[model samples]
Target: MSDRTPNPPSSQSRRLYQMTRGALIILPLSIAVVPWGILAGSLAVEAGLFDFQAQAVSALVFAGSVQLVGMGLIKAGATLSTLLLTTLFLTSRHLLYSATMRTRISHLPLHQRLLLGFLLTDELFAVSSHQTRKEFDFWYAFGAGFSFYLVWQLASLSGIVLGQSIPDLDQYGLDFAVAATFIAIVLPSVKKLSVLVTVIIALLLSVLFSVQGIEGGIILSSLIAMTIGYAISIVRKEPL
Candidate 1:
């Protein structure tokens, strides 16, 4: 064995420590996310999945909205091709996320960036992107991602285990949890009037589409709203 002593945390380690601390700070913010997980579990069970299978989706996929969409498609007897297409449309926003994050974590190795990309959810990205501290590093992202991942999985499992007992989610307003979580994630990102306007427009479009009984109403609304938002931002020359 080599006789070299292990060095204390270097600059990279210090940065990781800051990132971890940041993760700790934001972990509790995920309380708003639990209900969505619960809904996913319930939907999974309702779609003929066993509790373990439902729980596995939570632990593996961990995207609440996508889970719901997938379940709906499964219920409709969608083919694998259709399901993959739908999932791609729903998750296309990650392409934008990857582009933006490239600048933020550029100093990290490619493998680390890839790992972080897997954990990049709306909530974690929203919080971490605003971090200006140089010390904030991969650990911070990891902490946030890992915590959210674990809690989401557990909450989903709980829902799966108890979905049979809980017959009326609408009565409990649990279905709204997904919306609430999205709102919570979004509110912090609004820093200007342009952003606020975009959000309002998105909401209006979403409501209109939902009222019209559009399939994939939320996704449709998001795309319309984002398109409108992008147009307004471009017209105004707003710096994103």
Candidate 2:
């Protein structure tokens, strides 16, 4: 075992210097995400929030699915606890994302690490994992994540203003954007039956609990699904 860090190849360094690589890598997904952000903003506004509220949630939450779910819950006037639980559940996948990134990013300064954590989204994760790079550059990830973050905020702002003016943006079918984006994320990772089972179980449990009008159903379902998946992994000595 050696304490010294291995140097990345010169080609990897050259790839890092290619300023447009990260942007190019993220462009295709950004189109999907922008529509989803707009949908979230429009939905939030239609749910009776102030324009600032729509914009604030987009800027602060930054997780598209969680924002959409939170907007729905808010429209229903769900309890604060229910809202919290659902938001937590929606963002629970980030725990795994953060854990996976830790080995690559732990050497960074605390502030930089925090920024990356804040900017971590499904699209950014997909772009990062899909790209084949010999070494991880924080800037490369930052470029991809930052572009996504900026585009989403702008799209949300656009929708907020449009919702105020039109009040009929729902006909545009923007709701499909986030769901489509999710499929794009999962399709790449379903290389194993266990992984598929985990997804099915989570969805099934959530629906079952929702049908029963169970408070915190999303969280309960997600937690149980994760637990079952973990047990399966341990039994098989393989990751789901």
| TM-scores vs. true structure, each candidate | 0.70, 0.66
* Candidate with the greatest lDDT versus the true structure: 2
Q: Report lDDT per candidate.
A: 0.74, 0.76
Candidate 1 lDDT, tens digit per residue, 41-109? 888998898877888888777787789899888878899999999888778776766666777777788
- C-alpha displacement of 198 in model 1, angstroms? 3.9
Q: What would the per-residue lDDT of candidate 2 be over residues 1-240, giving only the tens digit for each residue? A: 232336667556654654357666677677666667778889889889899988999989898878888888889999999999888877877887777777777789998788888988877776676443345667788888888888999989988888844334356565466466567766787666667778889889989998998866755776788788777778888842
Which residue runs does candidate 1 get wrong by more than 4 Å? 1-20, 132-136, 166-200, 203-240
